[model samples]
Target: MLIGTVGNEPYQRVSSDNGPYEGAMLGAAIGAGGAGAGIFGARMHYKGIDNRAKRHISAIESREPVIQRKINKVNEQAENPRMSFIQKAKSKIADSGINQINNLRTAQLDSLNSKNEQLRNVVDSMQHTNPNVANEADLSRRSHYAQSYADINSHYDDVIQGSRFSKMKQQVDQSMEHKQARIEKNRDVKVSRLNKELEKLSDGRHKWGEDGVKLMKQKHPYAHVKGIGRSAAAIGAGALIGGGAGMILGGLTDEVNKHVKQ
Candidate 1:
C-alpha cells in the first residue's frame, strides 16, 4: 500500500493496512520509534518516542519569538542609515532592493556632498582673501576632490537604476540561494524512503523465491505467524465440514499472546 508523501511529491510505502487507521497508527509508531530508538529498552517505548519528538519540536517553537526579535533589529538597521548630508541620499535610494545596501550607498553620497560643500567653502574663502595665493595647491586639490566625487556618484546611480529587470533578477538569485539547502534536504528524504521500500520488497522476494526451499524455511521458521494464518486455514476448512474446537483454541491463544506482547 502507498504510505503517504512529504514535500512536493506523493510517495508510497508498502503495508498490510490500507485503511486510515494505518496512517494514524504509523504516525504514532514513528513518534514512538524515534523516542525508543534512543533509550533502546525503555517501557512504553513508542509512547516515549512520540512524546520526545513532540517535546523537541515544542522547544524549537518556543525560540521563534527570540529569532523574530533579532530579525526585527536587522530590518530596522537596514531601514535606517546615519551620515552627515545623507538625508537626500536616503530619499534618492528609498525604493532600492535592500535597505542596508541602499543605506551604505546613501552614506557614500553624503560623503561626496560633504566634500563638495567643503571645497566650495574653501573657494569662497580664497576669493575673499587679499592675495589670491591663500594656498593654490590646496585649492586645486579640493577642486579635484569635488569633481571626482560627483563622477563616482553619477556612475553608481547609473548601475543601480539602469534596468527594471536587474532588481528582479537579483531577488530571484537570492531566493534560490536561501532555498537551496531545503530543496536538497527534501530530495534526500524522498530518496531515503524509496530505498527503504525497495529493500523491503527485495527481502520479501528473496524470502519467497521459487524452487520452494526459501519459502519452506520461512513458512516453518523457528518463530512464525502461527495463529492467524493457521486459524484462517482451519476455519476455511471447518466451514465446509462444520466443526473444529482445536482451530478456535489455537487462534484464541495466538490472539491473546499477540495482545499481551503489544
Candidate 2:
C-alpha cells in the first residue's frame, strides 16, 4: 500500500504493493518500443520521399543534354545550306547547255584540223613535185584555219559568259542564299526556345532539390516529435489506467480475505 498528497490534499491509499511503479515502468517500456518503431517508419518514409524527388530531378537533368544536342544539330544544319529543288533543276539545265556548247566547239575544231591537215599535205606535195608552184601558192591562206579555230574558241567563251547564262547562275545562287538565310533565322528562333526550356529545366531541378531538402528538414523532425509526444501520452494514460486497476484489484482481494477470515 502507498499514500501520497497533492497540493495540500491527502490522497487515498493505493492498495496494491508496487502497483503504480510497476505499471509506470511497464507502460514506459511499451511506449519507448512503440516510439522507436514509429521513428524508424517515419525515417524510412522521409528517405523515400527524398529519393523519389532526387530521381525526378535526375530525369529532368538527363533530358537537358538531349535538348541541347537537338539545338546543336539545328545550328549545324543552318550553317550548311541546301539547294532547293527548283534551283537544282535550273543548275542541271545550265550544265547541260554548257556541255552542248562545248561539244559543238569540239566538233568544229576537229573539222578545222582535218581541213588544215589536208592543206598541209597539198603544200608538201607541191613543194616536192613543183618547187615553183609551191612558192607561187598563197601559203598565208593556211593561217586562216588557225584564225577560224580562234574564232570558234572565242564564240564558246562568248556563249559561256553571255548575259542569259550569267543571269541563270546568279538566280540559282541567290535562291540558295535566301534559303540559307531562312534556315538560319529559324534555327535562331528554335535554339532560343530550346535554350529557354533548358533554363527552365535547370531552375526546376534546383528548386526541386531545395524543396526536397526543405521539406525533409521541416517535416521529418516534426513527425518524429509528434510520434514521441503520442508515445509519451500513451505512457501516461497506460500508467494511470494500470495503476487504478491494480489498486482496485488489491482492495477487492483484501476485502475477500477479510470476509473469509471472519
Candidate 3:
C-alpha cells in the first residue's frame, strides 16, 4: 500500500506539472504553425497580385503603339481639307458643261439676229423705188423676214426642248448627286473609324483602372477570394492549422488528467 501510494503521488505530480507545460508547448506550436502558414499565404497572395499587375501593364504597353498610330491618322485627316482633287475636278467639269450649253445658245441666237438684220436692210432699200413695185417688194420682203424669224425661233425652241438636251442635263445632275453621295460616305466612314479607335483606347484603359475590380471578381481565383491582399488567405490557413493543433492538445491534456485520476 505504501509503494502504491508513492507511485500514485509521483504520477499525480507529474500529470499536474506536465499539464501547463504541454498546454504552453501546444499553444506555442500552434502559434508558430499559424504564423508560418499566414506568411506563406501572404506570399502567394502577393505573387498573384504581381501577376495581375504585369498582365495589365503588358496589355497597356502592347496597345499603346496602335493607339498612337490611330490618333495620328485621325489628326492628319482632321488637319487636311474636306475637298479632294477628284471632287475639284468634278466641279470644274460641271461648270465647263454649263458654260458650253450657254455658249451654244448664244451662238444660235446671234446667227438668227444677223439674218433678221439683212432682211430689214432689203426692205428699207426697196422703199426708194416705184411706189407699186416698192410696195410689192416690201410686202414680200417683210413676209419672208417674218417667216424666217418664226422658223428660226421654232427651231431654237425645238432644240432647247429636245430629249438630247434633257437627257444630258439629267445625266449631269445625277452625276453630281452620286459624287456628293460618295463624298458624304467617305466622310462618314472616316468619322466612324475614328470613333472606333477612340473607343478601343477608352475601353482598354477602363479594364486596367480601379473599375476593373468588378471585372476581376468575375475571374476564377479572384472570385473565390474575398479580399485583395495575399495575407488574407495566409491568415485563414494559419487560423485553421492553429485551431486544429489546439484541439489536439486539449484532447491529449484531457486524457492525461483522466489517467492520473484513475
Top-scoring candidate (TM-score): 2
**Local lDDT at 28 for model 2:** 47
Candidate with the greatest lDDT versus the true structure: 2
Full candidate order by lDDT, most accurate first:
2, 3, 1
Off-target runs (Cα >4 Å) in candidate 2 are 1-47, 99-158, 208-227, 230-262
Error of 1 at 256 (Å): 32
lDDT of each: 0.47, 0.69, 0.59
lDDT at residue 126 of model 2 (Cα atoms): 88
Candidate 1 wrongly placed segments (more than 4 Å): 1-164, 211-262
Model 3 alpha-carbon drift over 4 Å, by segment:
1-103, 109-161, 168-197, 206-262
Alpha-carbon deviation at 65 in model 3, angstroms: 11
lDDT of 2 by residue, 1-262 (tens): 2222211111113333333444344444444555566566666776677677788798897999899899989988999877778888888887777788789889989998898888777777888789877766636546787689889999998987784656687788888888899999999999999999999988778666877567656766535456556756654665565555444444554454456579
Global fold similarity of model 1 (TM-score): 0.23
TM-score of every prediction relative to native: 0.23, 0.46, 0.30
lDDT of 1 at 33: 45
Better of 1 and 2 by TM-score: 2
- Tens digits of per-residue lDDT for model 3, 89-192: 66566556556665766687688678767866776777777567767776876787677667766765566556354455556557667756665566667767
